[model samples]
Target: MSVMVAVPDSAEGALALTSAIAEARLLGTDVLAVNLGLRPISPEHLMSGETRITILERTHHESHAEVVLHALAEHPETERLVIGVKRRSKVGKALIGSVSQTLLLEADVPILAVKLPH
Candidate 1:
């Protein structure tokens, strides 16, 4: 089955993404990384398993939650969605709303929110 994951443009995001994809691979699932702007320049490592990373160059500025949800809507291959949620204080969450919040509240498909330790 296909699994969609939104990977943000950050090292922490990338690491969390790789971990999620790798785990999904082990579970015998197809992993697709919704990379908005920050596409993987190098081809995905084979040892890491097969993953299709789709980069949206036009969506870097817009809300990534919106971008990935729209992408999932467009792609028939998307079966489920996963995304990382770095721990946030109330003030932080207020200052910059979390994508996890948006996806949890708005996405039509099942979303697996990976909560990162603070």
Candidate 2:
């Protein structure tokens, strides 16, 4: 089994990636990271040369949440999914749909939702 993480273009995404790496180490598995951001993620910079990381580029047609869900479906060996979340008010969430929330509700596998350090 492997740990899957959604890497967006935010600090929370970076934190989630780091957390996924640690969890993968504990689980003795590799990491599958779906790149949902425009910026490229360098495996050498984030990884410690221990766990192998596979980066999957997202297609423009799908939303970030959709891409992650599709990845989960494509890779059944994924043991867990890690995603970055931000604190949002009820009103804000109502106004703008949340990808993390959608994943939490829809994903079949266990989820690790992380936020930026205070």
Candidate whose lDDT is highest: 2
Residue 99, model 2: lDDT of 94
Worst 10 residues of 1 by lDDT: 40-49
Off by over 4 Å in 1: 39-47, 50-61
- Candidate 2 residue-wise lDDT, 46-84, digit = tens: 754689888988875788899999999999999999998
Q: In lDDT terms, how accurate is model 2?
A: 0.90
Model 1, C-alpha of 60: deviation from truth (Å): 7.3
lDDT of 1 by residue, 1-92 (tens): 66777776664456556665776666677677777545552354324535544443435366787888788777766667778778777899
TM-score of 2: 0.92
99: Cα error in model 1, Å = 1.8
Quote the lDDT for 22 in model 2.
Answer: 91
